[model samples]
Target: MFALSGCAQQASSPGADAPSGEEPAMPDNGDCPVIDSRDWKAWVNAMPGPGAETTLIVEGAVDMPTPGYTFSWEAGMADRSAVPAQRLHLTATAPDGMVTQVITTENVRYEGPAIAKEYRAAAVMCGDELLAEITDVVTAE
Candidate 1:
């Protein structure tokens, strides 16, 4: 359940699982159940699980404008960091199969007046391993 933070915190997006204005769960030692709208800077160093395996998780939040829409997401590795992969990839794909993969962490936002009927954003760690996805329909325009 991802919610908007800093902006658009008052309105709930379509198909949202959590209510707006609700506070995100406090991070216990920089770990959270889901990477929602909360303080995530410390999440980078959090090794939430056991074993040498690493996992990448992406959490997305959407906002509706008059004739268009905007999406924002964040990526985190809630496990061991010293995995074999040197790079992490976060990809966004539309219903029409338009895929965008960002190697750096800053390209997590997607906005347009209807790129497709729906969008699926994913976080892939260690190259070929798929970790998580967040999908929802675009309600604006």
Candidate 2:
């Protein structure tokens, strides 16, 4: 239930100081990559309870400004009743102190009560931007 958004561009070639053959490091441009949907996973699992208790879990990663940044789910679900799909939101928060210029990868996850309708796909959103869309959903007992 989080909503986050940002723009990012791939870092250019390594600078003159960098050693040859070394991969170029991410620049301090404060930009994050748009996560590919293939990197995301969504699933539903039944829980132990008298009734049919179940939980929906979504896992993915987001590029943050620095290693000190943290990511989390927002607080509500988007209404996608028109389609057999679910839309989840996420957010990122930067640390309070000084941080390095390197871009960091933050793994984000969410586990909540499963909704009544089973969705065939799940879309991860950051504000109005679509981060990823998990089309293959797993259901487990």
Candidate 3:
């Protein structure tokens, strides 16, 4: 069984001239980039349930620079310490500006030292009927 106990933090600033598609030093959890709004639709639709086509936003506050670090999700099923963390459900509007449901299943799990820049993410599907999904990963900063 995989555990969510091990993870590290990563910090990087988006370069002034950085082009699109470049990943920035992301907080543990928060909003998806503004550019991701349109793409979020396909993501929510790819989940296992119908009507999961919304862009649910989750936020995390980090106290890194100190001792242990933490990540949190809004209305998420698992907490930072939930052993064998399973699934996370998020709610948001679809790309068309219509609201829909979104469900995400836990697939990839990671745990370890921050130096490795390791973390976990999952493939999420959304949409009332069905749409698409993309793999998202979370690393420290």
TM-scores of the candidates in the order shown: 0.19, 0.64, 0.20
Please list the Cα RMSD from the true structure of every candidate, rounded to 1 decimal place: 20.4, 12.8, 21.8
TM-score of 2: 0.64
Identify the candidate with maximal lDDT: 2
Runs with alpha carbons beyond 4 Å of true place in candidate 3: 1-73, 78-86, 92-118, 123-134, 138-140
What is each predicted model's overall lDDT from 0 to 1?
A: 0.29, 0.67, 0.28
lDDT of candidate 1? 0.29
Which of the two candidates, 2 or 3, achieves a greater lDDT against the reference? 2
Instruction: Give Cα distance to truth, residue 3, candidate 3, Å.
Output: 70
Candidate 1 residue runs with Cα over 4 Å from true position: 1-107, 111-115, 119-126
| Full ranking by lDDT | 2, 1, 3
lDDT per residue as tens, model 2, 48-140:
668766778899767664687666675356555643577777765667887786766777888877774366787877756677888888778
Q: On residues 1-141, what C-alpha lDDT tens digit does candidate 1 reach at each position?
A: 245455555665444544667644433422112222211110111233554222333333321112122233333332333321212333332223333432222123322122122233323331243333333222222
Which one wins by TM-score: 2 or 3?
2
Whole-model alpha-carbon lDDT for candidate 3: 0.28
Off by over 4 Å in 2: 1-38, 47-52, 75-83
